[model samples]
Target: MRRVVLRGFSTEGGPRPDRTALLSLGLVVLFAPLAALSLLPLLWPLRLAGVPLSLGYTVWACSAGLYGLRPVQLALARLLWPVRRPTAAERERLDLVWSRVLRRAAVSERRFRIWVVDLADVNAHCVGRDLICVTTGALAELGDRELAGVLAHELGHHLRMHTAAAAFLVWVLLPLQALALLGSGLALPFARLGRHLRRTERGFGARRWALIAAGRLEAGLRLAFAAPGVVAFAVKNAAGREAEYQVDAYAVDLGFGAELLSALRWFEACAAPAAVAPLVPGPRRARHAAAREARPTHPPLERRMAAIIARLDAAPAAVPPQGRGRGRSESSRTLLP
Candidate 1:
């Protein structure tokens, strides 16, 4: 029955689904706190036994709950994360571009707002509501029309409510990172014991290993206290990737998927080689590095470009009206897939 409901929810298009948003919020409300509570168990033994509760675990739990709040905060921040201390002129420029994009898109307040940051990274993102973020590097590298293509893609995310879902997952992921660090050496043993205990508790062997792992990890003393958090995080991130694809479909629907793909290829071809691991020394640092390598705010350019190409080919075209003069010529040029 639950699977059926989720399957129905996955059939997305048209205006946004209120039930889906509520369902997601419900899950965050129901599970995030429980996941946070489970973190306490990982440290139970530390208080009773000699081992201390790694600071990472505490931070992880807090982050899980905090994740529920980020979309709202991010909406409030409004293109603030990658930027710091914008000069008056810089702010004005961002405003001009943002206003132009919003006006062109005909986006309503219910849809999203465009925000530009000063970061050098070539990335753009949108969280819940109409809050969209584009970096300085992204704006500088791409032409105005090409950048509009990027903005269109981000608007696709807003149309899909990807931000709301992402907000709920952030905190849950933090604890998982802590778990990966804490259970590095003992992960296997704790997983084995956790599985057996779960099977025994249910009176029959049920295949809910993931939940069991989370429960064990939260239980604090289960030896693999961080196991559930790590496992759950991976699952969530995988889901996050799927959401990106859905947004890609929306981008195509908005008449810019192909252009977005070309832009992505251009970005990837020019980007500096990003390191796979962090050089920082700390418990959570390794997990941070791993996550960065996994998804540096957005998926790798190659994969994203390929996905966009695939989506564009799979769907019918919906080209927007070309601008006047030389810019129109550039837009008309066929970009090789």
Candidate 2:
């Protein structure tokens, strides 16, 4: 159980993005089609929202749907498409927990299911109504209070329908992922020629040569046509971090802010010893990550903790003191992580 503190505490900061971020994000408008086009065929089997169409329409509509429903579909895909089946006991326990939480959250049980995956990773997330997966490691590492906090955070995603919001982003990025792959392949060859051009321009004092080099760089970028893809990928990731803050706010509103904060801290501690693994590169990963700024789905842990703290300060809660307490309080049962 979470130990309630009567003292007030708040998150360190709030969400804000500058003009450059906004400008960068604008690129998504153009790139969404590319991602939608690429990812549509893969998702056609789901037939979500009853918008089945001719093959041509499938591509067009899917590109459009990427903006609206792809996230939800992706979430469903992640939740249900397990590489390994869950143990029966774990499945039953997870179902019970999910059923109870859904009732409390006033969500339809039919709309979602929470499944415990036996993976050892300390992570838990919801992809769609059909599947919510919590790694066994995460459950084992956290106390019941902390676990509830994590669940509440995930539940916040369901309540706010963040999957749909995420789909809007995916529509723009599916194409970018492809472009990134192409761009990475071109990186070495282009960089070598680009360096020679720059050196020749400096040594020979050639204005025309410099201009030509600049044009080549521009042409190379255009040929690669990676800007829209790159920018879309970056902003899509930025939006995901923002979504994390919004979900944290949801936990606070539900009176589990402290628990969530504690859970986050514990998760960070557990993850600290592990070397930071590259996300996409090499045989197991993609390579473009080295060439560009890396944007990720979650906010920085310190920043996230700070945001939670700031929220706590702005609106204090009367948490009942633990252990030496008088009569048992109902609120104690609903401890935040």
TM-score: which candidate is best? Answer: 2
What is the TM-score (0 to 1) of candidate 2? 0.59
Steric clash count of candidate 2: 17
Instruction: Report every candidate's CA lDDT.
Output: 0.51, 0.52
Q: Residue 34 of candidate 2: its Cα lDDT?
A: 68
Query: lDDT score of model 2?
Result: 0.52
* lDDT digits (tens) for residues 29-49 of candidate 1: 655655666566566776678
lDDT accuracy of residue 301 in candidate 1: 45
- In model 1, which range of ten residues has the least summed lDDT? 1-10
Please give the RMSD of candidate 2 to the true structure.
10.5
In terms of lDDT, model 1 sits at: 0.51
